[model samples]
Target: MQALTDLPSLQQVAASLTEYWSPRVVAEFDDSYVKVAKVHGSLAWHSHEHEDEVFFVLKGHLRIELAQGAVELPEGALYVVPKGVEHNPVAEQECHIMLIDKKSTLHTGNVTTEKTRSLNEQLRPL
Candidate 1:
């Protein structure tokens, strides 16, 4: 696992993806879990009431849509969505991103949908 491994390559982990929207845990540091996901299309609008989510674009482009506005993130860009803010992520094309969030964070806040994934699913080996 990542705890015993040395500096993992995000690219390699991202390249191992076989589907969209599914995130794989890569490491854990303190209260946060580092993950990577290949995304396309849009994720349901949701919010984490008690945790902020950190998103870093690794490739392609991503857009974080909030109730009042939206931010477009290109490769090498990063953004942090504060807790309790309703937002959705959309990628017009396949995009790879790294997410840093608490271990207790849910897949999609209070709303469960077809895209929602359990923590066990996220922790699967890449």
Candidate 2:
């Protein structure tokens, strides 16, 4: 029988991305997908009704804005936005982030905007 392979490096996969706000699926764990994104500027505010979204900062800084407050995440920091909470992610400069969420989770959650990317798009080879 053949064995499964290890995932590619997050640093290497992130470096290959030339687009902002678009995430690429790099790995899968349990019922979730591990995604990497090169982000700058801000993403539209949205909420996942049934799934919590986990964000890990790999490089630079990231800020997640909620209606009540905002949280800042520096490199190596991580945060989890609970389900049903509205939030937006912003990066003043180029930042690399890893996201872990359910496989059925949508890029923009309940709101669809131009920044919304489909699973098919994210599944493209790095």
Candidate 3:
């Protein structure tokens, strides 16, 4: 949650995250939700037809695979996947990332895999 003071620590949240591919909602603004997750392998190939997805690598490395090619991001790197583009997020090693997505955005887009988490799950008490 963003505030004028008593700010939340992303580092603290990232350090406490234990589940891979399960994103936890950390904050929100306007129509967007801020999420953090610890990802180690890969998420399903999917696309959000109506909303773009932003991924900010908080730790380790991340590879966003697109049909054209894969974009690699080291720690502190950010990438925005345009709407209607298919993509799969992968991390060779354990990685922490913050995702900025629309409030209605689904983590798996149109495909649901074992790792897919519903919005309610992400919003649960931490």
Candidate 4:
């Protein structure tokens, strides 16, 4: 069995993230992948074409803006953006967040702008 102590602390994971709009992979299990990110200001508008993504606020507040509406997620709160839905995430201050999604999921689906990134490119320190 795995022990919780064996897992890295969120603080340690947060330290490894170096850029905005980029998420670093921390762990994976079955069909889901876990990522950590440090965010500030606004992120590019994008969407996942084939997978839903969960955003969990670990430190500060996170705002998710969609075509229908926008939601504010404070620390300890979580929000799930369904597949094929266009959404943009924003942070007023430096915020730490965790994301859960399928292994094949892309951070920004089909939209290959400067903001699009790969999970491998955003690996966090373990």
The candidate that achieves the highest lDDT relative to the unseen native structure: 2
Question: On a 0 to 100 scale, what is the lDDT of residue 24 in model 4?
Answer: 81
Tens-digit lDDT string for candidate 3 (1-126): 667667657767877888899899999999999999999988989999999999999899999999999999999999999999999999999999999999989999989889989999999866
Q: Could you give candidate 1's per-residue lDDT for residues 1-126 as a string of tens digits? A: 557467658977887799888899999999889999999999999999999999999999999999999999999999999999999999999999999999989988879999998999999977
How many times do residue backbones clash in model 3? 0
Worst 10 residues of 1 by lDDT: 1-10
lDDT of 4 by residue, 1-126 (tens): 889888778766876667877888888899888888888988778888889999999989999999999999999999999999999899999999999989989877757778777776866454
- Order candidates by lDDT, high to low: 2, 1, 3, 4
lDDT of 4: 0.85
All models, RMSD in angstroms: 2.4, 2.4, 2.2, 2.3
lDDT of 3 at 35: 91
Residue 67 in model 2: lDDT: 100
14-38: candidate 2 lDDT, tens digit per residue: 8789999999999898999999999
**Candidate 2 TM-score to native:** 0.93
What TM-score, computed on C-alpha atoms, does each candidate reach? 0.93, 0.93, 0.93, 0.87
Which stretches of candidate 3 lie above 4 Å from their native place? 1-8
Poorest lDDT segment (10 consecutive residues) of candidate 4: 117-126
Clashes of 2: 0
Off by over 4 Å in 4: 1-6, 124-126
